[model samples]
Target: MVLWENLQAVLAQRGVAGFGVTTAAPFPEMAARLEDAVASGRSAGLPFTFGDPATAADIRVSFPWASRLVVVATSYLPAAGSPGAGVPGRARIARFATRDHYRPLREALEAVAGLLTAAGHRAAVVSDDHRLVDRAAAVRAGVGWPGKSTLVLVPGAGPWVLLGSVVTDAELPVSEPMRRTCGTCVACLPACPTGAIVAPGMLDARRCLAAVLQSAGWIPLELRAAVGDRLYGCDDCLEACPPGDRALATATAEQGSVDVSRLLAMDDATLRAEFPHFYVPRNSGRWLRRNCLVVLGNTGGAAAIGVLAGYAGHRDSMLRGHAVWALGRIDDPRGRGVLTRVAASDPDAAVVAEAATALAGTLTG
Candidate 1:
């Protein structure tokens, strides 16, 4: 108890959004839920979603002697009056990935772990890493309640807080769980642009635009238009959440949007370097370029036709394929002309197929 009190003071002074403690007991229910998701094929695209319930539920698996788990929260909200990333010819970035929020959250957790270590107790920290169900830990810790968006909504920060935790062997007091719930509010459900949130607190990663963008294969034809101008991550569901919204006002979801034309202009290394925290498959920029082309198609209009045309000849078949879709989305004569050339000359069957689809849409519309 004394150790917890000391940790609380330390966290408060460090500007952490909030902190709470829970027993490091096995979360059998959470494990069962994940098991059901994986077995039922509900977990898609998210690699961490794999494995049996034990891996997802029990903190003891990772920290064999852990007796207490200290969950921490840090606001990811943009500072007031800060410049936003949204622009007319660019794509929007989710508020979380606008920058590295996890770094600070981890730092805070490490601080708590450090205090435990100095007291001769074993301790470890984790954040977005798959070792722990952070939201479940957070809920048990009484730091917050799970909101309809599947995000932990803190008392003052809504779903705008990033989560991390320190697992320690110290037998600290278990936190009192929050009594709050979203009640009848379900705004996050309909706010999902791609209908990714099929129900309250449930997410279908396959239909999630952010997850799809991070995926390795072709962008599903049915979902391309919903990608809109989003270059990375989707915040619509989080944005629609109304609890603790006073703190939410400072974050501009558009703050991290990148200039699609400028981003597409960069070489592969530069593009990945520009967003160090983004989850690009294979750490490759090709997927990012694929996303940009889609954004250009949705919102680039006449100004983006030239850009789309250039990508139509890109060496990567995937890029060329997405570019074809973008060209069709722009529907400019010049873009269509590029698609015509691609339909005839492109070497990849998939690219040609994409071109055929894009061109067919033109004829039918």
Candidate 2:
């Protein structure tokens, strides 16, 4: 108990918003739920969620001797007036990725691990890493309750906090689980732009625009419209929650948005330097470019047609396909002409298919 108290003090000094300790027992219920989600194909296209369910459900599997888990939540919400508002022609980034919150949280967790090690106990830190189900750990630790959006919702802080944990062999006093519930609140269900929240606490990652944007390959045509001006992740469901409003009020707005045109103009090196957090594959700018194209099509004016037109014949089939869609979305004669050219001569079958679809929509409408 003294060690646990000392750890709590250490976390408090490190600015960890809330934390609790729980026994590292296997979460059979969580494992069952994950298995169900995967079996139902609700977690499709998410590689991280596809690992061994048993391992993910148990901290002890990752650290065989682990007996205590310290779960911590840190608020990443920025000050209310930092930036991220009223920026036209810019794609919106999710609040969590606006800054590097993980680095700080990791540093804090490492410090906690060090404290445990100094006391002759073995400890391992995990954050954003897939060693265990972080939300489940946080719930068991009494740090927060899981909201319908599948995010851990801390009282007053809502879902704006990032979660991490320290797995240790020391037997510490365990905290009680939180008693709060969402009750009759279903605000996050209909608020999902892509209907990703299929039901309370159940998310279909396949239909999630946020997951689609991060995923490799072409964005499906059916979901592109719902993606709208988002360049990276979606926050509609979180934003609609009542608790989330309070979180935003205290959170500082992110400093800036990536201008859609500027992003399109950036090369690989420039994109990486500007937004290091984005999961750019092999340091390629194509993914960012693909997202930018979508935002341009959703929000750009006549000038955007010219920018998108240039990519109609890009070497990358994915880019070329999205460019064709962007052109049709702009629905300008020049864009239509470019789509027509791509439909006739694009070497890639996928690009040709996308161009044909875009052209068909344009011609008929």
Candidate 3:
């Protein structure tokens, strides 16, 4: 108890904001998963050790061991007037992924780890590394529950919060569970554009736009159409939550609104300059460009025809395929020749079929 008070003071004085500390469930299933992920070399940048629970148990059994878990929620609201605001011609970026936080979050947890070590406890900090479910751990540590959109929504900060965890061999007083407050509200469910939420708590990752975007390379046609100009993560579910809306508005106020048009107008060098930290380039420029084209197609007007046409002959097959689809939606004479050329040589059956259909309409017109 005295140790808990000391640690709490350390966090408060260091400008570290958080809810409270809680204990992890001593379950074999959790331990096994952590072991498997770490042993298989899958826990590259993750924070948990392969034998974390065992290590803690060993220390407690043989020595005067204390085990405690501290969870923190950091505000990662985007800049005021960010591109997340409702606008045409630009794609949306998930607020956390868009801004830089992984580095700072890591630093804060390191401080917590140092405090635990100084108190005669072994400590480790956990961050998301594309494998571990840190959110689940945080939730169990009484941080928060999974919102309907499947994002962890901490009370005051809402779902815009980023989570971090500190697992230590320090026996400290545990904080009471933060009660699940998602009572009777299904706002996040309907907010999902493609109905990907499936049910209240389960998410079908295949249909999730954020998961899909991270999956660069060859994108399916139906999915591409659903992309709807969102080059990065989809915020429909988050923006749909009643609590989430206020958070986004608050985030918007703090960070500014995000304009899609500003993003669409960027050249290669300009995009690099504007978004150097973005992960959009993992699939190269084609995926994001294709997403912008899809958004333009959805908006359907004479305005974006030139922009779609410009990418009609892009070197990447993925970009060319999506460009043809965008041009098909535009239904302009300017797109006919390019669509014909694409239809004639396209190796992908889906792209060819759509191109043929569009070219047929052009010939008849």
Candidate 4:
């Protein structure tokens, strides 16, 4: 217990917002739940814990040398910054991702691991998309209850915290698990613009704008309109959650908005360098540009005409397809001119098809 007390002080000094411990037990409940989500296609293409539910749930299975699980939550942003605020010609990045919090979360976990190591115990730091059922561990460790948004909501801090875990063979005691629930508050359910939250505690990632943005392909046609100038990350649901309201930070318009046109003009390397925190698929700038096109499509309007036109003929067919979609979504006569050309002669079949659709919509709309 003395070592545990020292550990808490260590974590506090390191700026960890909250933490708890649970026996490194297999998360059987999480395994069952993940299997169900995966079977329903709700977990499709998700790169997080859903990848291997069984192994993720059972921390010991992957790290058989582990005997204790230490879960930690770090508030990356002091408050949720600029929620749902859209400035035309610009897009919003989720406050959680306005900067990377996971790195610090790992650092804190590593600090905790260091203490255990000094005590002659082996420790492993597992966090953020590393195959641990982190939320389950957090809940079991009394960190917080899972919010309706599928985030671990620490009291007062809400779900505006990042989660990480330290696995060790130490004999540290576990914290009593939290018994709270959102209790009938379904505020987060209807808050989602794309209806990603299907139930109080269930989220269908297939329709989640946040998940869609991180995913490696073109934005879904059905959800593109709802994206609403979001270049990366969608915070509609989290911002709407009442618990996180008190902690919401007022962001200057300049702080929250990214210029869609300017971002579209950035070459691949520049995009990666600017947003090392973003989960760009294969580190390709095309994916980031792909997202930029959707934002321009939704909010760029006439101001985005030039950038969209340039990308419509980009060497990457994927980018070309998304740019075509943006051109179609906009109502400018110049946009129409570009779409007509794309519809007639873009080499990619998908890009051509998108161009034709945009052209038809122009005629009928």
Segments in model 2 whose C-alpha atoms lie over 4 Å from true places: 79-88, 252-256, 280-283
Better-scoring candidate (TM-score), 1 or 3: 1
For model 4, residues 1-365, the per-residue Cα lDDT tens digits are 77899899999898777899999878788889898998899985675777788788888778888889999998755643563466778778887777675878888898999999998899988887546878888999999998888888887777788888889999898799888888878888888898888887788989988888888877778888898878778777777777777665533333556776777778789978988878867887777778888888887778889988998888989899988888888888999999999888988889899999988887788
Question: What lDDT does the true structure give each of the candidates?
Answer: 0.83, 0.82, 0.64, 0.82
Model 1 deviation from native, Cα RMSD in Å: 1.9
TM-score of each: 0.95, 0.95, 0.77, 0.95
Answer with 2 or 3, whichever has the higher lDDT: 2
Q: Model 4 off-target regions past 4 Å?
A: 249-256
lDDT of 1 at 136: 92
Candidate 3 — worst ten consecutive residues by lDDT sum? Answer: 56-65
For model 2, residues 1-365, the per-residue Cα lDDT tens digits are 77777888889898776889899998898889888888899877465535677888887777999999989998776532233633546788777777676877888899889989999999999877666889999999999998988988998778878899999999888999999988889999998988889888889999998788888888888998787888777778878888868667766545546688887887878877887876655767788889889888887767788788887867788898998888887768998889888989988988889899998988997
**Worst 10-residue stretch by lDDT in candidate 2?**
79-88
